[model samples]
Target chain A: MDFKKKQTEANLKPGDRTVPERKIPVPHRDISERAQEMIAAPYNVFIDWNLNPPTKDDWSKIVTKVSESSAPAVNKLIEDLGLTVEQLQIGGVKCYRLTPENIPENHRKQLVIVAHGGAYVYAPGIGSVREAAMFAAFGGYTTISVDYSLSYENPFPGAIEDMIDVWRAILTEYDPRSVAMTGTSAGGGLIMATILKIKELGLGMPAAIAPSSPWADLTETGDSYKTNEWLDNILVSYSGYLGLAAKLYANGNDLSHPLLSPINGNLEGFPPTILTSGTRDLFLSNTVRSHRKLRRARVPAQLHIYEGISHSQLSFDPDLPETREAYGEIAAFFDQYLIW
Target chain B: MDFKKKQTEANLKPGDRTVPERKIPVPHRDISERAQEMIAAPYNVFIDWNLNPPTKDDWSKIVTKVSESSAPAVNKLIEDLGLTVEQLQIGGVKCYRLTPENIPENHRKQLVIVAHGGAYVYAPGIGSVREAAMFAAFGGYTTISVDYSLSYENPFPGAIEDMIDVWRAILTEYDPRSVAMTGTSAGGGLIMATILKIKELGLGMPAAIAPSSPWADLTETGDSYKTNEWLDNILVSYSGYLGLAAKLYANGNDLSHPLLSPINGNLEGFPPTILTSGTRDLFLSNTVRSHRKLRRARVPAQLHIYEGISHSQLSFDPDLPETREAYGEIAAFFDQYLIW
Candidate 1:
């Protein structure tokens, strides 16, 4: 058939913005072709949500399943990195410690307190271990990943208070200057909130900190909320999973409460910090805003935005060339402050 | 040191965008971090010019090294996926054919012609087998990859002539409707140029084509040339490496010639086509423009832009969710026309 005839026959409105009528005749393949394609690949690395957020009840079920078993992943990390995994009672709250077998002598005293991020309610115990183990393996740091209380069971102050509990315990043993904090997504927001809470409680701050793509804005006020809505798959739109998680965590409290939304917090005396995020990350604006805030406060901060990466991809494959550059940047930054 | 005092000591002009005077005191590692970051993940997956295009002597040396061994990669693919690899001489030009162990009976007659990208100089011999084997393994299609001549010794029409020579032989054996043409980077441009050449030679066109981030423009006239310059690690800027490759391939020929620079070509009667590129891809503008041209011609066209990814990341990892999605989209599109 001629090009014009095929065009009319297919009946595709080439310029139409609408989903073109499926006149393109494609034959379906066998089940085997579909089976061969499944390679244990996890779904979207970024969150995915359309215009409306999920109902409260729907989110509750989703949270439970994601939180259920991260143990398998934790065990894999332990075996892969030859790291020691131990549980510690931090101010009565339990936290996991992941220390690599070979910590290059100088990095011995420095411990990174990891607050794992899963929008506040998911990926608790094993999440902390898996994330912390990579930090240990990549940066050669002993780590304490705080398994803070979740918004699912305790809501609002529960997670922040638990983060404080672990922070208090760490400060009690390690010299304030010898310690540091790091987190991703909600865990990242917790890091900023803890910094504020520490100041409020008259506790000394750590020597340095790194918050990788923190969900610092509880409200969908950042530019990326709209620009990166669909670009970021896992967190499709700000008002979806993130908003649902925020409402559940806030549990009727003001979304902009300084502790609840770290973007609104007072960031004074924040330690020399390094932050990371990706361009397509839904929380890219959140991360960018936080970096601007730190810069405004005249805090020495380094922000590394990996091109074309999604949320938390910096920590995804420790061996990926970009991932190594990311953590290597953190290790170099910490060397100046925490090595003492 | 007190936080307030250390802040002054560090002397960070947070908002000052003057590259920060480098006083952050990062101990330089063995390759300046910048130097270490430059790897030819095929550079642009289609274009790689180190600093400057080589003189005749240098080009000869570089070509020999790259052509020396693609065998190991081909062997690995054969072992990994139960696929058969065979060499064929089409119109006296060498090409590689890859076929899956079991072709679905209905689709056995259809085949995909791959034009491998290597700035027209690299990845010849086993490059075809490694890339084509994956399509056979994943998409269940027999793939024939043309190992076209490069500009190092044979410039301008050398590669395009070789591609047409192979295409002519393939068309003689298989019905034009039974074949689909696909390429990446330079090969993508080759597909467009060849289509124009095919029309000139009065050969029947293939049913469809898919070009993954084609180096469409031979000149630096695209918007992304400036926007995605430093952002795209591999193809840092159009003026740098791609420019050199374009110059070498054009060999002082008219760049605006439709056959030499496909972006300038008439896309009328073009086959149903799909194009892929990343947001950070330097050729993003090239891909977007080509899609526009096809759409203007009312040729059915689909473009998939992977978020924040650099050039040609679609084929970088066979197992990445995005890569799978990229290929899946093509296979589905091809099935629409090729199955009949």
Candidate 2:
């Protein structure tokens, strides 16, 4: 339908009254055409047209697809770095780990624990671990990537318990305030839950946390869950989140319980946190809501929302200026809060 | 009051049961010994203390004392910078202007128009104007400090009219997206009012806003008015905020009107905002409430509460790292959103 017809049908004021007609037209030739096309299309259609899904498959297919696709890349990256793999016992669970020997001795003193993401369904792989090792080396910090139990195998408390043990080991070895925890997606949720657990256990909180595109609320009540339904480019719909993994992780437990959905957790005294997400990411609301909760709890929190980027794009394209800038900011936050 | 005595009198559980005895070892240190001493003093000594009016003499003296003491410091730091100033006709009122040259060119070319703080009773002076110039220089934005009519001389719409005129001039000169408005105390309220006026006038929205230690609600519904009481070193007590100046600024206006209180303002579509204040600051509640309102409105907003810092300390002690960091973050935010 035409603009006027849609306005009339909706009983809304004319377009001129709502949004003034641009006196100076859009500069780019193609942009104007695109703008016109967008204005002509129904709002939902426009949203869907702009939607960019990173993975085009059902949840049942996701694990196998990711495992197969990421394996070769992970293997090649790990081989190129000549990293050594090791096993560590954490909270009575054996976790896989990797340490790069090329890292300078000075850098090996400061530890960075990487909690891999996949809504708690996947293990820390060669792809993410190699990147974490590279970042830790470059940033002059010793890094360990946790290969915790996934929801498909053990679920819920298994992952949480593994993380707590890893954290406890770190604390026993180094000052708690000097430690920095980070992750993306479900790993982000783990970071938040880890901090919450530390506080509840009366352990000293970490100096800082950086969770990118975090799946904060497994329950999915964020307005963006509904508002950015098709506009998001990654994690296409909340169904992959709230519908599938949430049930899998819950193991028939209450989804709204703070332990399952950290967004519902009382955020009174978490450490300084930095949350990053792209506007086109399906988990945008997860990051935004988490940031809001952290702020309300009087925790020093910083949130950076990139306008047009997609989820996990930063990790995939670390050289992009936007990605580098986002990581740089997160690193800077860690630098300020994480002091050994 | 001793915990054991209070618990016994109230027929409540003993403190040892609720709180571990190990935590109660330093009970006496927690009590205010100075307060106890004061209360135990002779009746004659107490009478003599009350007779002295706490060294300031009276309310008028208190206001004058603060204004006079703060002036020279403001002037020495700000006015000496030689910022470019102009007198502009705004809303049929004369408004002082600090031009682009006053700010560092490399920072950003955005404009920041400021309304000075004086509880709407005092006129803009060398101190506030200088502070604005310094802020522009440090913040890397062209700043126009409004010398709006004050309440003692001109009431209600008089200051609002001047602000509206200055905003009109800014709109005419720059793209609204390239401009941000800010203020401290009463000026903070004016910034909120200016936003409402601009919205009502159908002008484009600004990119961002930062209101520091704003006296948002003249009616003083903020719990700090009672709770902070003597603990707040500045604004000494709520009476100074609610009794005289609040009544004067209102000029019979509704106390809860968002324009007057602005803590109650409808915050839809306003620019991304950052608010800063100190825990002990008198305007803590104003900042908190404004933050809550902005969040409720779904406007991207941030609030930073600095521990132990008093009212306007960030501006006052710009040389301090914390102050510079806080302002630097604000400048960075404006850089991100405000495209020149």
Candidate 3:
């Protein structure tokens, strides 16, 4: 409480010390009601969260549990947005195609490929298609959601290969210039890796890509991984299942492999990218770092960080203004870049 | 700790409720030592901060005290950067001209006009010239530091008019297209208002403007005002001196007036802009909102947010990498837009 001493200490160069402790309280004003509630909710307060599933089968059950739980919201979103969803087999892989009631003239030729996020192992089927449906309903573009291979049985190259296969299949029907891709969290990370794989395979890049709250760095190397731990309501810490999932996805691969963590990849000639994350999002640093990487490569990139939401929470409820604003930024970015 | 019930609650619509509680701890990993130290510092833990100065004279005294205290560090920065500072009278107002040790040939014609940050009432003289020196030293461009009229004696139109006076004077000798402007905090806010006034007065826009952590909204309207209150080491809350300074600067005028808060101004055709803030910066939402406004107006804008920093704390030490990166972004943005 000695003001003068603390001020002097602040002016001094920081030295090594034991971990400093302080408690942060939820902001009661300025932010929206939904944001406040999301931040205030202890969504990741599981005491058993540190325990990883004992086997791959256990991980599959966890994925199923999450997918089943998230089904109602995806159904609600589809109903509210007046979108039709259908299962498809594309490139010999499972996929979901979402179509809006009317395709506007300008976007008639455009196709959006989406990679859905549930870390790397969860959110199969409809859960994996939620973001694609949102983009389709909001942007009026026919969207394809790739149900990439989960890490429980297939890892690393598996998800990346599934995405590339879908991209190649889409390219046969749609022009590459008219194609755009986007996803959230692990899906965000996967799409980035997919683009890298596409580049490696000499498959052209999409017109634009939006990686929202990407878990771009599998290694806990971003500033937010630490700063936003316990603060971000979801993905509360890399120490939880997120860490276990990162290892599961790596499956003995190097965490720093550009394919595993695209931020470390050669980003030169990457497509125009628009990134989204909230102030309290655990992947904010990931998004920020990715934006810098794109900018460093001289690629046109736009970063939109929402006020106080956490980890893809903007997509949590389609009714939130922040949700609309987040999508609007992405849609605008795409409209500017994506070819008809 | 009941994950199942909490998950259900998270899915429900957020309704009216009592203020929720949370306790955020400092991240021990993934961020720079300096960032960790700055975030962990108890610099703003002043029990007496809620009290404001009773009179304009008292406020002036506080300003002088702050300037005097900050002089040592500013002096160190000048010496470290090998920058030479001189007093100048431009447009019949006091200012400082900062010259780097060697002005590179390409930058000889480039002028960077800097407005320093101090909440509009503090950091007069050399303290006010620190940011200009840093920009000049790092960017290798000759810079002018505006010693604008303070709110204690002159408010509202006073600072804006002074900036315009200086701009008009600079325009007589230097091509506006060859010039760039940068500032932090109030300086950030002031430069923005100045640009709006420049547009109103038929003066051509500068090549680019970099507003680092601008205090663009005077109404305490941004989400970070509450969310980053105590978390941001500097400008801990709006209820303290910052709130008083806001009122003093507004001088009883509506805080929402376009010139008072330039985010509300017509930013159409505004020059290329680069904005910088930090994850923990109180002015982060201000920067984010300003970027959105500029983007909405179709202005070329880029936003760079540091991992874990507070309001204008990047300017505190020129030795810090974040400081270098922040200025580098501004410099690169200016270089891309400014005519050689």
As a TM-score, model 2 comes out at: 0.49
lDDT of 3 by residue, A1-340 (tens): 6543443354333332112333344544335677676766664532233458989999998778878988888888888899988999999889988999998888899988999887788888888777888889888999999988999989888999888788888888888888899999998898898888888899877999999999889998876775565557677667778889899989999998999999889999889999999877889889988887787688888888776677888766777766777788888888998888
lDDT of 1 at A58: 67
Pull out the clashing pairs in model 3: A24-B24
lDDT of each: 0.68, 0.60, 0.80
- Predicted candidate 3 versus true structure: per-residue lDDT over B69-180, tens digit per residue: 7788888888888888889899988999989989877788999999888778887888888888888988999999999999999988899989999999998999999999
Expressed between 0 and 1, the share of native interface contacts present in candidate 3 is: 0.09
What DockQ does every candidate get? Answer: 0.02, 0.02, 0.21
Top lDDT: which candidate number? 3
lDDT tens readout by residue for model 1, A1-340: 8532332233222111111111111111111222112111222322323223355556566655555555776688688888988888889998888888889888887888988888886776665566788888888989988888877677888888888888777777889898888888888888988888888999878999898888887887654454444334345455455677788899999998988887788786899887777645667667766765675576777655544344675665555665666677678778888855
Angstrom error of the Cα, residue B217, model 2: value is 33
Cα deviation in Å at residue A287, candidate 2?
Answer: 1.5
Q: Write the per-residue lDDT of candidate 1 for residues B1-340, one digit (tens) a residue.
A: 8532332223222211111111011111111232122221223333343346349568666666655655665687677788888888889998888888888765699999888876666666775555567777788889988888877778889988998888888877899897898888888888888888898888988999998888787877554554344445456556565677778888898887888778787788889998877655777767767875676577877665554455665564455655665677688779888754
Candidate 3, position B279, lDDT: 79
Ranking by TM-score: 3, 2, 1
What TM-score would you give candidate 3 relative to the actual structure? 0.83
Q: Which model is ahead, 2 or 3, in terms of TM-score?
A: 3
